[model samples]
Every structure is written in C-alpha cells, then in structure tokens.
Target: MPESGSVELVWLFGPFAVYLVMLGVYYVWEGKREEQLRQRYEEAEHGQ
Candidate 1:
C-alpha cells in the first residue's frame, strides 16, 4: 500500500514539475522574440 501511494504521488508531481519548467522556457522564448521584433520595427522606422 505504501509503495503504491508513493508511486501515485510521483506520477502527480512529475507532470506538475514538467509543466512549470516548460512554462519558464516558453516565457523566455517569447521575451526574446518580442525583443527581436521591437528592434526590427525601430530599424524600419529609422530607415524611413
């Protein structure tokens, strides 16, 4: 019974941990993409 309980706990927490990690990665990627877009816009405006 104790072993089964431990396995269940691991199953629940494992996905939660993976989700948090992926969320952090997504946020960083989005921030970098936005920065690149902003720089391109600024360059375009100056070229005009």
Candidate 2:
C-alpha cells in the first residue's frame, strides 16, 4: 500500500468501484424489466 497522502489507492480501487456501480445498475434494470413482463402476462407471485 502507498502512503496515505499518495494517489495509488485511488488507482487501485477506482475500477473496482466503477464495476460495482455498473453491476448494481444492471441488476436493478433487469429486475424492473422482468417485473413488467410478468405483470403483462398476469403471472402470480407464487405461481398460484
């Protein structure tokens, strides 16, 4: 690890942080799309 006052930590963690953010956005979007499709077909929550 570099010194506290150095910029190495940002370089190391930046890409990982960006990846996590993108992953979260994708999951949320996919979930919403799935819900819309399920509702369009009138599917029950528990298959009842």
TM-score top scorer = 1
- The digit string of per-residue lDDT tens for model 2 on 1-48 reads 668756777888989999999999999999999999989677665566
Q: What is the lDDT of residue 5 in candidate 2?
A: 58
Candidate 2, position 1, lDDT: 64
Distance (Å) between predicted and true CA of 16, model 1? 0.9
Clashes of each: 0, 0
Which pairs of residues clash in candidate 1, taking residues 3 or more apart in a chain or in different chains? none
Q: State the displacement of the C-alpha of residue 46, model 1, in Å, after optimal TM-score superposition.
A: 1.0
Give candidate 1's whole-model lDDT.
Answer: 0.97
| Candidate 1 TM-score to native | 0.83
Q: Mark the regions of model 1 whose C-alpha exceeds 4 Å error after superposition.
A: none
lDDT of 1 by residue, 1-48 (tens): 579989999999999999999999999999999999999999999999
lDDT of 1 at 27: 100
**Predicted structure with the largest lDDT when compared to the true one:** 1
TM agreement with the true structure for every prediction: 0.83, 0.71
